[model samples]
Target: MTGLLPDNDLLVQFSQLFQQRTSLSNMQAHWQQYHWKETIKLGFSNHKHEDWKYTSLDRLLQYRFNYAQKLKISKQQCDCLALPLDSHRLVFLNGRFIASLSDNIYESYQVSSLVEQKNIPVAVHAEVFLHLTESLAQESLLIRLAAGKKSNKPLYLLHISSGQTDNQNKNIINSSYYRHHLLIEENAKIQVIEHFVSLNNQSHFTCARLTISLGDNAQLTHYKLAFENQHSYHFSHNDLILGNHAYAHSDSFLLGANLTRHHTSAQLNGKGSYISINSLLLPFREEICDSRTYLEHNKGHCHSQQLHKTIVYNNGKAVFDGILKVAPHAVRTDGKITNNNLLLSKQAEVNTKPRLEIYTDDVKCSHGATVGYIDIEQVSYLRSRGISKTKAKQMIIFAFAAELTESLKNKIIHQQVVTRITKRLKRIDI
Candidate 1:
């Protein structure tokens, strides 16, 4: 596999399919020969690549890469960041599911493996993204949620990555690249809380794709918290489809990793559908964070909103790109997006871009972006109140983060997110 990217296994096999060298009828045969169960390969970058151009992951893979095989986890260990959730718990160690570390029972949802299902059709609307992962990922994890079910309890997902490498006696060390495929059925309502944390100081990378399909009148609430070591890299892609009158809300908190990128896409395919996305990222110590969001109004009477806040300090960098596209026939569509960045140091950097593409004249669409440092007047007023400069700065940072965290519908998850924000604020030397 020298000269062939370790992350290119799926793409390599997919190349054969695209070239007609391998037939769909013979896919099982190829799967047996070139199939990697849990490990994956990344692609080489060219000028034509749209996604990786800004992220620049091509240079990072050349470094010694290590993949984590199945690792053990104890319930008592790494308890400081844990959140109390009553729903099913799914735990992963180095991108592999660790059954011993997960809670098997749940009152609201049933969890099963993708391999266990005999037949499952790929949704037509999600075909493009599915093809991307199928050509890139080595293995996939599937989550199937039943219809018309509502959960007050939150589904907890804990992802633990350790910097262990599988030598495999090869010149290049084995590093695990992870991908996941999530599907929520029609008319289902649920709350999912995902936490990604690094166990040891090992450089690693993660790429994930999630697709959700909402039935008429369905609803969903999603909360994500990511904390990685300063040496690791992270990439994630989210795709959501809304049915007629369906609703979904997503709130995210990002705190760690040297480099992290998030790509989110939501499509309003049915009339009267709605979605709201709120996110906050706090970066320090030279860490870099970037996020791109796409909201498409394919049907009339659909609405969407996006709001993102970022805080950068100590030479760290943050990037935000928000795009809203209204189709020709999607009249009366309403969409608004805003991206705001708060710079805390003279050396810190931020890039904000908000774009709107409208094909319909009757639609209401607006977008805005801003990047600025804290107001000196506000700081002086706080200092005059007998508060030290450091404490005042910390208070201002905490208040900025609380804006996004306050939207969490679940009380317990809201508190957990606040705790993470507080920890990030305390890490700042200012």
Candidate 2:
């Protein structure tokens, strides 16, 4: 629950579980500083909440979740996930960072736990879940790239969850909470790749948040891959802020998860800053995926581009809401937004909303959204080329997704993303 729910039972259970684990004066006092007491009183968001209106949490609220604890899994099993093997890598299992699995690289970047560096910059729109993660997670991963420093390799992160139901703890569901902070100082450059998966391929809920700050002349490139099992629920938020001459490129691949909601907000606050966000949401077999993105141009000479593509099949549903806001003084702001979706079956559907709110007359902004089935003309062309009907459909779907995937700069990561999407498409019912 986001602490906005009417049900006090979960909050009670969570409090009770905390009390039962340790003495009130001991570890129990640790959870209080998170400001959860006030947030819980505010309660869970309903259909009336504008941002959450399209996606319902009723299906997820039926289960009771327990806070995840640290556990060790086999090395062979870790390899099975095919996680990226970057030189500078950090691994977190169930929300707990594993120092043993993390790379001890130094001299190029600064990596510390939130416990040591408590001064984290709060983005503009801090949500209840961000505070909730702070109250529960004792330690969070914090990475800071030294100003004017450039890294030869990308920073890799593996966030995996694996476990069965917590039967011993009153049958509580196993849910994990994780928080990460990234700082790119002035004139610094860095690349980060994050892979989220269910290590055991089991059902669970994951709440995650990533805060990014880019200083003047800094550049950060981020790629996120979410491949949780369809039986699981996952929610995440990305808060990114850019400074003068800063640049950002964010690419996301949403493949699985029974119920997934992702909120991304980016603010270009300094002149000459630029941002490009591209996403591919491919959900199959009754999964529900929702992506909400907001881009704000607060300064002049800034540009933003967003291209979102989704393929929903087997009675699955996909929702996308994108907003581009330009400040009154943000002259010469340029933005482009496009959302295209393909529904394979009659039962599959999508809801898309793309808007532009321009406060100044000196901005150039445009948006377009389309939802429909595959073009019969293209399918027929492929079929005439001796391709099977099923294979032809698959080809067209891949073509639609390739438009965004081809924009990726890292070949290794690009291959991995393409392979995952192809594998998932192969398993979909024709």
Candidate 3:
């Protein structure tokens, strides 16, 4: 692929595959075709791109991945990967919804297939990956919560990537695309968790997008958990729109994938809207994780807070880019962003950039970043207390992650996250 230009081979392969999928209606096909052209025009981001400078796509683009025509996964396999919590579950294998593996829809909320819906929303951003998913996704889900309603349990969206092997018994890279939309009306409240996992150790690629809208006085708690195999590549985009007095809290855990990129954008369009985003990224053994967030305060009295932490080990790398913008009329806005990184290995690296652009007065905004290693004094103290050096370092690392994982209100989810963190830390040599 040329610099900043679309990969012609990949685009041609995608076009051929898109043409073979007969699920889309005539109108839907036409709609998707328009996006396909836009995707080509926009092309993929290169290392020169400011937003992608710290994360390189060269390794991801080198492979030619095929779409999985069929997927085989058992209920037992899915159950093994599911969180131990009471939730309304929807399962997808290779981007296709698996009704047999999903829970029945309850009366408290409305759920429908995107292909069956007459009105399809436009893409929130014009990026290549976002548009590519919009153009090629064969299946999607739309969920709506009515006014004055509240969900008794969280909604769980599970995605599994299962790639096939060639005749030589060698694994062939596979690709999957999926889109989801959620709407919460006035006075509504709900929690959602989007979880991604791999059914096998084969290399694969997954692209997903979720769009959410919150009406006046609505509340939403969102979580994204990625646990794909270490050989996989993953990308996700989230768009959120908030009305007056709306509130949203988002937490993300990046624990897998050889190369992973997550981007989130929130528009505070109504007065008194509030949003908080917290993320914990653990990249070890040559893994790379990139995270970006954009918050726009369009109305007065809007508030936003972001905290991102990364633990890098064994030549792993992490990136964090955050931007907070306050419009001219957005008075009394409050925004804060902070990123902290802990490197356990001399070869490990982190790049963090936090920015604020405020056009109005009476707004309080701040941005900062810190990159450091384990405190030698603390480690010495623990060693003097008869603690092993490795155990002391592990304790400090766990404490750094616990500061954010402890914020999870659900006991089951919190414990599960902690368990994963512990498991990963055990693999560290330190």
lDDT of each: 0.69, 0.80, 0.85
Is candidate 1 or 2 superior in lDDT? 2
Clashes within 3 Å, all models in order = 9, 4, 0
Residue-level lDDT tens digits of model 1 in 1-430: 2333345543444344333322223453344233222222333433245544444444454454434456666787645446676657777776566677777676656665444222333332332223343434444467766777776667777777777444453333223434454556677887777788887776776555566667778888888787777777776767777889889998777778878877777888889999998788877877878887888899999989899999999888788878899989999998999898899989998878789999988888888988888887878999999999888887787777777876676787778777777777777787
C-alpha positional error of residue 183 in candidate 3 after TM-score superposition, expressed in Å: 0.9
Distance from true position, residue 283, model 3, in Å? 1.2
Provide the TM-score for each candidate, comma-separated.
0.83, 0.91, 0.95
In candidate 3, which residue pairs get closer than 3 Å at backbone N, Cα or C atoms, i.e. clash?
none
Estimate the lDDT of model 1. 0.69
Tens-digit lDDT track of model 3 for 1-430: 2457354456665677677654557776776787788877866767777776878877865666677766767899889988866899989899888889899875577888765445444444446777788777887778899999999999999898875556354435788987898988999999999999888888889999898999999999999998888888998888888999999999999888999998888899899999998899999988999988888899999889999999999889999988899999999999999999999989999999999988999989999999999999999999999999999998899888877998899887788788888888887798
Q: What lDDT score is found at residue 405 in candidate 2? A: 83
Candidate 2 to truth, TM: 0.91
Error of 2 at 249 (Å): 0.1
| Top model number, lDDT | 3
Q: Measured by TM-score, how close is model 3 to the native structure?
A: 0.95
